[model samples]
Target: MKFLPIFLDSKAGPILLIGAGDPVRARLRLLLAAGARVRWHATDGDFAVAGLDAVAASRIERLETNPGAADLGAIVAVFCAGAGEIGVTVAARARASGLPVNVMDDPAHSSFIVPAIVDRGDVVVAVGTGGASPVVARRVRERIEALLPARIGDLAALIGRWRKAVHARIPDMPLRRRFWERVVDGPIGASVLAGRSDEAEDSLQAIADPSAYAGASAPGTVEGRVTLVGAGPGDPDLLTIKALRALQDADIVFYDELVSPEILDRARRDAVRIPVGRRVGKPGIGQDAINRLLIDAAKSGQRAVRLKGGDPFIFGRGGEEIEALREAGVACSVIPGITAGLGAAAESELPLTFRHEALRVTFLTAHKARDASSVDWSALTDRKMTVVVYMGTTAANAIRDGLLAAGRSPETPVGVFARATRPDAKSVVGTLDHLPALVREIDGGPAILVIGDVVSHSAPWRNASPTPLFHTFQMAAE
Candidate 1:
């Protein structure tokens, strides 16, 4: 909010420079590299930086100490560095002459501050903290540098060359926008990134004329992409960066019941939201219906996102969705998220795997237990193996019986976390025998069951103070 960002057309004319310091030399190099004619006015003669000779001969000019008002008239901008009292005077004169002035380290005197720039030719990014913190701004620029590809600027230049032609081909504003997006984000962009500029140009032109290149490169027809994104364990923070991008890019998001509202709120504001939430005992749309919807949307060239809570592959019916997409010839990808068990571990500060205690961890869903009688409950009874059950609140009694019948001890420590990582999250600490009775108390909220010796190390157990559970999963008034 402190500074409004604007990219100047520096190549318009010569830029005025007043100083003899090292910083001034660096600024000269940048100005010259950007193809700006820099007219330097310094008390001392030496105007040498690392790559001074690399710049063209006529690009730079060394002038006498004091520049006249006529000299400032020819310059587009002025930068003063380490001129001491002379710097202040020059700043005043530059302002009076109605030119944008930048006095190094003096925000008050300067009309503009040069930001830490990530110069990718046409794809330039500038990070500025309004001269408040240059170091912080530089650090932010570094992070941006990592996220952007090296050839991104080249890719942009490739698109720039075809801009006028594309405009002529697709005149409608919305259609033109869609055409550019598809070309830039699809095969043409990929070709540019891979150093195939010729191929990229061909792709771009092909996209512009779909009828001619319909079979070879149908860039006009963008395929619908389905991303199965995980909305991690009720915490928006736990969502992966890739998942966030998918949400933001989604044209239509088909989310489930377990996904939190906060996570859904991160999606593009104008994106269509369709709730296909399916919970036990709830009258809801089936998986088949959801698959059909996803296929239909994708076929219509819409970017569809199937947003689910936690890791999509882990008992989330994500495989089923992938299979359905494969059968329907729609492209689908998965973005992983922190499941409830891992989220509960962080929230409770309990290690899922301890060296001497629980060494292995297993995640299961009682609701989707295909063969309950044939389930390997006996192997799960091992004390060293921590078992996490999702959607088991409704079948807690059956789970309790199954484990107990498999010779698992009734006194085994069990922890139930409801709405894990959420502000109104609740927990119940008890033994395996207490699970059946405890399940009757918990109501509509999504809950996870962690049954292991590791539960002994959890926060509720360590604190030894639990909100007593009342009938119907309601807490008695304190």
Candidate 2:
């Protein structure tokens, strides 16, 4: 961040405003609305207040003296808009005095830049682009303004009123924080936001114990739990809303290696992150150890999140994690995500099941040659069944042999989609006999192999030249 975002106390002291014209007038309105007394030095001598109310206009003290030569002792900050050379001169003086100053549209001379703001009484959201693009900032501010509840400021004010009592009641810092979380995320806050502040006040006052209200079993101990969240096939946007919430609420996150850094970036900034996934060849903290970590985190009254790539239930060992949490008496919940196979199919425009040509779809894992050999390939030999093989890159040759020996046609179309839904995603398409070769054409693994005639209907296949054996398509970065 080029400039640290902070809300300066508008009531600190009178702001020195030296400028003229409509831009200066706009800045004047913003300063007055923020409740700051202004010491105005209108360079053009046009001290007009045409639209401002009497009370606000009365606070402005217009001066004829040049601001550069005036006393700087009482000024808290400085703002210069449409002031030309005089603005730059005043900016240098303010900087020398160690005061914050903003020269409109001039970041080089300004100590701070104003941001596009969304105001809702006590609640305010500021959007900035470090003086790069005001339009972009305004656009973001619009989105935030729409998402925020109209009375969210009322809810904040309500909390402010009750904060002292709650803080005294729940002296433990963590428990006190959780108590506020319960209030803001629960019915009391909802009531306030719904314009029922009186009812919300009564509800808050009726609570006998703030600690108990915060979900603590005792006065000082908070109740912690685990949430299994799906990271969703490499793309951060594919994450479900609930999954996003869990990440934000997590006190600590135990994430898989497959979870993208962009996805992890969405978690609470202060939350502790620990990687616990096993890579293809490299060892990881074992599953038993991972389960113990989750149990321990909850036992210590920390909200923990086990972040897995793709839907937790679909070959993600989510069921196993749930069992472990249950056995350890840890409360848990699950949020599903888009699995890799489905993500790959959508990204490549490949249908897992097509009309008539493919009536059934099967998803299985083949991490090793022995694993592929043990599969009941005969059942998968049906011409109408589409087969999706996970972790099949290394065992591609074995997969090809097993299906061919099981009476599956060697000419069946197949696709290898790698890094599905990511910027560097790639795909290779060919017949079943060349499935291993097709896999070899891809740059890397963490890929899935799709087999059956349905692969011929994919975008990659359609876009490819009419090659008899194979076609490769490296997807351009989005």
Choose the strongest candidate by TM-score.
2
Instruction: List model 2 lDDT by residue over 1-478, tens digit each.
Output: 7889999898999999999999899999999999999999999999987889998998899999976775677899999999999999989999999999999999999999999999998998889999999999999999998899999999999989988988888888778878888899999989998899999999998999888988889778988899999898899999999999999988999999999999999999999999999789888889899999999999999999999998899889999999999999999999999999999999999989888889999999999999999999999999899999989999999999999999999999999999999998999998999988899899897898999999889999998877548898887777
- Please give the range of 10 consecutive residues that has the lowest summed lDDT in model 2: 66-75
lDDT of 1 by residue, 263-347 (tens): 9999998889999987677788888999999999988778899998888888788999999999999888999888888887778
Which residues of candidate 2, in runs, are more than 4 Å off?
Answer: 1-3, 67-74, 92-98
The global Cα lDDT (0 to 1) of model 2 is 0.92
Clashes within 3 Å, all models in order: 1, 0
TM-score of 1: 0.60
How large an RMSD does model 2 have?
Answer: 2.4
443, model 2: CA deviation in Å?
2.4
Give the lDDT of residue 34 in candidate 1.
86
